[model samples]
Target chain A: MSPKTACFLVIGNEVLSGRTRDSNTQTLAHALNAQGIILSEVRVIPDIPQRIIDAVTECRARFDMVFTSGGIGPTHDDITTACVAEAFGVALRCHQESYDALNALFPEEAFNQARQKMAWLPEGSTPIKNTVSTAPGFSIGNVHVMAGVPSIFRAMVQWLVPQLEAGAPLTMCSWHAFNVYEGTFAEALTTLQGDFKTIDLGSYPFARDDKHGVALVAKGYDSHAVQEAGRALKSLLTQIGVTPISGEPAP
Target chain B: MSPKTACFLVIGNEVLSGRTRDSNTQTLAHALNAQGIILSEVRVIPDIPQRIIDAVTECRARFDMVFTSGGIGPTHDDITTACVAEAFGVALRCHQESYDALNALFPEEAFNQARQKMAWLPEGSTPIKNTVSTAPGFSIGNVHVMAGVPSIFRAMVQWLVPQLEAGAPLTMCSWHAFNVYEGTFAEALTTLQGDFKTIDLGSYPFARDDKHGVALVAKGYDSHAVQEAGRALKSLLTQIGVTPISGEPAP
Candidate 1:
């Protein structure tokens, strides 16, 4: 079966303003990849309602699944739930179950209008339990809206991933050719790609630890093809008089 | 003057495939912030031509500037320059200067069709010299095409930033209150935000060094306003019975 593709949307004004560095996209990317879901796009957008609605609407249609982080808090800036409801053409409804759960989790003194906001979700959506925090995220159609807090987001994802459909996991291999410039191996790499059409080849150059090298990676759904491509890449490096290491170079 | 807003488009299949983690977005985010530019959005897209063209076209029109990284290498997957040219409704032309530079850098025997592909750029674009590599990235309209390699990307940005007009630099301050949760100070923060209309306040929940707390950040173009907001936040934390540290919590 073809891989189920996914997109991650990180909604926060703080991220765009450079006050916050988004680690959620990276987290989702790795999580989705391990579960055999192809994470095709990651967009970090602000708290604008129109932008959120448009992105969620478009991404839900384009990809198999859409995971969003942030803007689900009890602050004025948290507009994701309402915007998501608007995008799906659904009304925001106070989820009775979520409200009851939140009520139980917090002391009566602490349960205020601010805390009640977490109970709202798009109509026809189901809640994804947040083990880290009592407030739950919800899934409507293909969209999963989770809290911006990393722990809560991760916890929700862990609870939710197993329920979704997964595709064949990708097989990958790499060769780190030390002291290699891409210009030197460009022609050979191109030829190798032409020969192995199924495998996706990536050449990443690095300058670290006072040394420079290129790491050539081959990945595909077929393990044998990936291995074959890696072998060919290593042979090409050998032909060019550069010894190829098995994995990423140090530093 | 208001900060010139920009967006970064990271065009690479490897990044989406989870084979490579992107550092270019964070690098550009900090660089743009330091130069007083607002980086409003960042998208990690695949090597698809239409996706690249569409994102570039939209971002270039939306923001004052668009900076793109990756897909500028000498491989079949390298199509960012061509896609970017298409987005601007311009033809890809063989940049004579870049061609001559590349020719001079490479050996006559090694200069092949694959390596020669780097000379192609959108018509009416100016080359941004890559000191790390001979292949030059170019700027067309409001978009700047840059290398994917961190060292090369940073170098190109360093060379190009001084030429562009920058906005007023933002002033920022942070307070990390130990044992504090967002709910404890949510009301005070809401009030503080209402008082400081121009400043952007962000509350981030962090779990590190075996302690969990919320870090409140205040940022604005006006230094005095940001400072005042920081003081208010510190005071609010104190009132809530938590001593707020002046900076980020220890990781």
Candidate 2:
């Protein structure tokens, strides 16, 4: 069975400028992989209007789902919501639920124009609840927009992933053999891939404690095929005169 | 003066599969920023030929420079070189320097077909020296390709960045205050941003030891403008009755 595809968009000037390290891509990658929604691509873009709109419009059409992190905060640089609205050709409307949730968090005066900006979302969007900050993320069509803060982005993922259409989980297995150079075993790995055409196979080289090794992985929706590929990988390692570890190499 | 714009492409399935955490983006981001080159976009794409070709073709034309990591290894999945050649409508050619370097690393018989694959590079490309590994990465037109291994990637970057044309370094300054709500001060930030029209300003929220604060940063190539914006941020904090802390908040 073909897995659903998703794209991740990380929008922030801080990320582009090296002021912030984006942890959200890995978080979303792990989350989507678990749900069998293959994370096909990830783009970390600057907080610019045309860039944001272009990425949103392009990725949304190309993939089954598009998830964006950052640029939803209550600041002058936070232009994601507006750009997304522009991308969808929709007007901004007061999301009453989010407005109420944010309103209750602060005193009347504290809920200033900046705070009110959080309440204006793309028209006809569904609000994704935020427990960290009262300002909610929203979903329109296939695109889900969330916060950029690691803590908040995680919370939103936790809330959103479970609600997504459950998919068949991918089966993964790995075998690593020490002192095995990738170039030495590249032909065998390629043949193994051909033998199990449906399975996704790759070899990654690693260096640890002055020793080198190659970690081979087999991934697919078919459990039986993945296990068969694992055994084939193990047999290949043994054939190459090295002891195969059942999982990835120790860091 | 406008800084040169660059785009980074991280080409690997391991990253998309969550099998690897990409450290190269942050490394490249910092390196590019120090050179006064703005990293406008970054894409972490899978090890797919069409995707690599499309991204390389599009980004090379779009940005002043493009940097790519991963998919240049000897393994079968490593197709970046050929794909990049295809992107430019060129052919693969034996980069004699890289070929000679790799041949020296191995005994006559040990340097097999798989290892020989690393010697072929995109036509008309100049090889970027790789200190960690014998195999070299190559640059074609505006796109520079390097290894994905953090250490090797770092070494290649160190060698590459120094050779590129240098530009004016960006000046950065920040001011933070505890118990500062972002929404409460967002208006002042907007006004301040208008006042310092050329400077790029932003406010980042942080929570430390159960207290929340907002750190305002002013960044630009103009050193005086950045410092002037920093003083304005300090005044904004003082006006709101919170003592401003110079630099970012303590973790």
Positional deviation of residue A133's Cα in model 1 after best superposition, in angstroms = 2.1
TM-score (chain A only) for the predictions, listed in order: 0.94, 0.95
Candidate 2, clashing residue pairs? none
lDDT tens string, model 2, B41-75? Answer: 99999888999999999999999999999988888
Where model 1 places Cα greater than 4 Å from the true spot, the runs are none
Please provide, for model 2 over A68-161, each residue's C-alpha lDDT reduced to its tens digit, 9 standing for 90 to 100.
Answer: 9988888999999999999999999999888888898899989998999999999989998888887899999999999987878888998998
The DockQ value obtained for model 1 is: 0.58
Model 2 off-target regions past 4 Å? Answer: A208-212, B207-212, B249-251
Give the Å shift of residue A176 in candidate 1: 1.2
Question: What is the lDDT of every predicted structure here?
Answer: 0.85, 0.89
Compute DockQ for each candidate against the true complex: 0.58, 0.72
Residue A82: error of model 2 in Å? 0.7
lDDT at residue B225 of model 2 (Cα atoms): 89
